[model samples]
Target chain A: MSHVTDEVKGYIGVETDVGRCWDVVERGAVRRFAQAIMDLDPAFMSEEYAAQTPYGKPVAPPLFPLMQNRLPYDGTDVISERADDPDYDGTGGAGPSSNLPPLPLGNLALLNGGSEVELFRYLHHGEGLSFRHRYADIYERETSKGLMVFVITETDYLDDDGGLVARVKRTTIRR
Target chain B: MRDNDAARADAPADPRHFEDVSLGERLGDLQKGPFTTPHLMRWSAAIENWHKIHYDRDFTQQHDKLPDLLVNGSLKQNFLLQIVKDWATPHGWPWKVSFQFRAMDVVGSTLFVWGAVKRKIPLRDFGLVELELGIRNQEDRQSTPGKATVALPYREGGPVPYPFVPPSADELAAGEARAEGA
Candidate 1:
């Protein structure tokens, strides 16, 4: 018997803006990210060093663009909003941050299941990237924790020239 | 993965050759953290997700059933990429990677990201190196388990193709057939 409803299954091909960052890959931003991750690879950080590499200029770490998203609000709005529910996860609590469609399964806990990624090229400084997302599938299974839903989404990060940057298949587990 | 610190220090300064790699060869360990609140905070700020599960111990423990502030999966993936990317750079391309978030690593623990060459296949232009990799906490508990395929240049070549294109469908089918035959 299926625990997932027909309506939920209908989302199999639904689209979401999981993220879309078209801004130029900034060097400062790349440095901050690499520093935070503690990856001091010159390919990602130093333009002088990267200039000597095959890429000719500093490139964002392969996965750096995935984290580069701009929220639609200013900082004050968020601070004021977070003043109440001290328990708030800083997720703005206003919406599912990824722009994922509201799940019919209310209040269900969402967990990161895993991901499959294909990288075609390095995203470099001065390059702009765009994202396209779709609900690839939704299914349910009986786990030791009881019934859980697995939602898979496919996102493509494309360069301005329509070149492939990275293609990701992300899975979210709902319990 | 083999951790030959002596061998790593003696690694060639030039691009690596696919012919040099062997199955079961261990990659240099890429370590990150003893991550603290500031580390988590920086990552959250960079990614723009203030999910308190990573910073708020009270909410994470009381509201959610977690022991402490959790390291962000987003952060983990980036570290995974860095491990493969730095290892592949100057020669190889970290072409395709897949990893699962099997377990959670709470903040305040160092992570040893390790990789080992699992297999290699000869291709028309270059060779494909498959690797098994993961993140291990201070206690040696694995968290993110992954597999990656890297394309390496032949020693005679100048460099792997820039903006490396994905193999076409025909190429993939042929590769599959070859694998089955082998």
Candidate 2:
């Protein structure tokens, strides 16, 4: 059974307007992120050291953009809405591409197939951010397990001035 | 917070110059895990990713039909980036990276992130080093296979330009010719 129907393919080229992140880069968040990744770079914490670096301020790690989006205080609560559903995967609400309409595939298992990222600069603390997501492509492949649909989404992470910080292409697999 | 001094000591102290790199040089490995549930939970919370496959064992096995709580491919990417960034930073920049999650490493797996220089292209101001990188379990099962491009300054030159500027078409054509000849 092919999962990539015409409706799914229609999403290609679809894009969302540039959306603001829920919060600006915060020191405590960056610190927790660094600790979770076990990367203790002083650049993420020490203003004294970071001031001498090219960025001229404490900067988050290179991939910190992945965690910038969060559920807004006034947004719908995905957790509370699905509290009674045993199958809730805890994956919805807000994310890099959450603004895009969900794929038509219903109840199919989803996987994070892979990703490609081009980083131009590290995000400095206190900087507000924005992102825009587009569905670049959609196709189906017959895998050993069965037929699977691949959804390719591209997200551009931008600083407040609209300068690009990173471009990420991610693949989502649904079977 | 962990010891920043120790982490700094472990990271490359000086800038890694393009002139100093050899084609086949191997980067020191960065190891993490026997990843526990707390590790997975901490990562999910840090990123606000509530993917149940990473934390709910019953749902993962019964519904997702997996062996155990799987390690986050998202989390593993950080390890790959860390090893590359640690080896190339302070003077260089990790310009681009791509990786595929070919296999699932369940919870309790110890992962070793590794990379090696595979190709080098010299530009007018700096150099680009291409690397083959991946993550391997303790049993040597390769899960994430990828490539990266890192920009490094010349031994006597200034640091690689920040917010890195890609080489121009003319510079790339010239670099390609030089790389082919070398």
Candidate 3:
């Protein structure tokens, strides 16, 4: 690990075109993710079961968006180039590259941090969801491991009623 | 409360007051285990997360230099949600919640999920409860940290009505057309 100056910029914000909103919210994708996660809960699969519940409709498991949404192709293609392009089977890895810019920003060692989300209601298949993403903040701190940079981002999801369905905040750390 | 005693605590001191909660209220902690590549495989297959970073170490190292098979960030978030749901259920508290991704949770790390209430509002239907959340690895380094808002049962009320749902037919069709064009 290398110790260096806090070369971190504050939050940056971006918007997803309305057209891409449905890319991840499809009913088939929702079912696939629900099964993949072993969330064999009946409500996620059965319309009849779901209709009996308070939701009165087939609902995807909570946290469905995290499972459904894919990173945009523009971003994915950029990383694929960096990963040197490898055969995929739904796992993590890019490839060996001595020179890859820092995640989002340039010149930093970024690590996979973690995130937390709250579900206002379980998302259902064929249900349309829209989101606006904003970078919230960045903090510089010292860790025993070394210098660390924390980037926090927030995405707001709205439903047909224009009511906010869920808001997801993600933070990543780079050294 | 003593750690041992808290461990054995059946429920919160008062259930109704759960809605009257404040920022300092400790929501307790939960432990998970044996998260492995197979776990990731199962989840990935189910979700169809074709992204290579989740499964291939060579791909990750060559491209991003990530450590061995990484745990899905969403899995960690699910763990957080499961913990909170488990903690609240004994008291018969069911709520609607919202959260953000704060970090990437890798394999071989032990996570301790905790939170504190940050704000509260009384909606006509339910209590709006907001809290700051944190998921720290065993190293005491916080991996992902963010905020959350939940719709809790009113102290004197029953349950909150569903406030968030998808758009209308016209709206969805328009969204579909826009998406296809894009």
Q: Which model scores highest in lDDT?
A: 2
- Evaluated with DockQ, which candidate comes out highest? 2
Against the true two-chain complex, what DockQ does each candidate achieve?
A: 0.50, 0.63, 0.19
Q: What C-alpha root-mean-square deviation, in Å, does candidate 1 show against the real structure? A: 3.7
- Candidate 2 Cα outliers beyond 4 Å, as residue runs: B1-5, B10-12
Q: Write model 2 residue lDDT over B1-182, tens digit each, in one string.
A: 12122546422377788989998899987788888999999989998988889999989999889899989888888888888887888678888999999899999998888899998999989999999999999999999999999999998877898988878889988987898999
RMSD of each: 3.7, 2.1, 11.3
| Span of ten consecutive residues with least summed lDDT in model 3 chain B | B1-10
The model with the greater TM-score, 1 or 3, is 1
Q: What iRMS does model 2 reach?
A: 2.8
For candidate 3, the C-alpha RMSD (Å) to the true structure equals: 11.3
Roughly what TM-score does model 3 have, to 2 decimal places? 0.60
Instruction: Compose the digit string of candidate 3's lDDT tens values, residues A119-172.
Output: 556666677766666556667678786678776666666666555666666666
TM-score of each: 0.88, 0.96, 0.60
Q: Please give me the total number of clashing residue pairs in predicted model 3.
A: 41
Worst 10 residues of 1 chain A by lDDT: A88-97
TM-score of 2: 0.96
What lDDT does the true structure give each of the candidates? 0.76, 0.87, 0.54
Q: Candidate 2: deviation at residue A38, Å?
A: 0.9
Q: In model 3 chain A, where is the ten-residue run with the lowest total lDDT? A: A92-101
Please, what are the lDDT tens digits per residue for candidate 1 over residues A1-175? Answer: 4547988888788886434463578888887877777765666656677767778877888887666545645324565676785444455433222555756876565677888899888888878777777888899989887798998988787888777788889888877
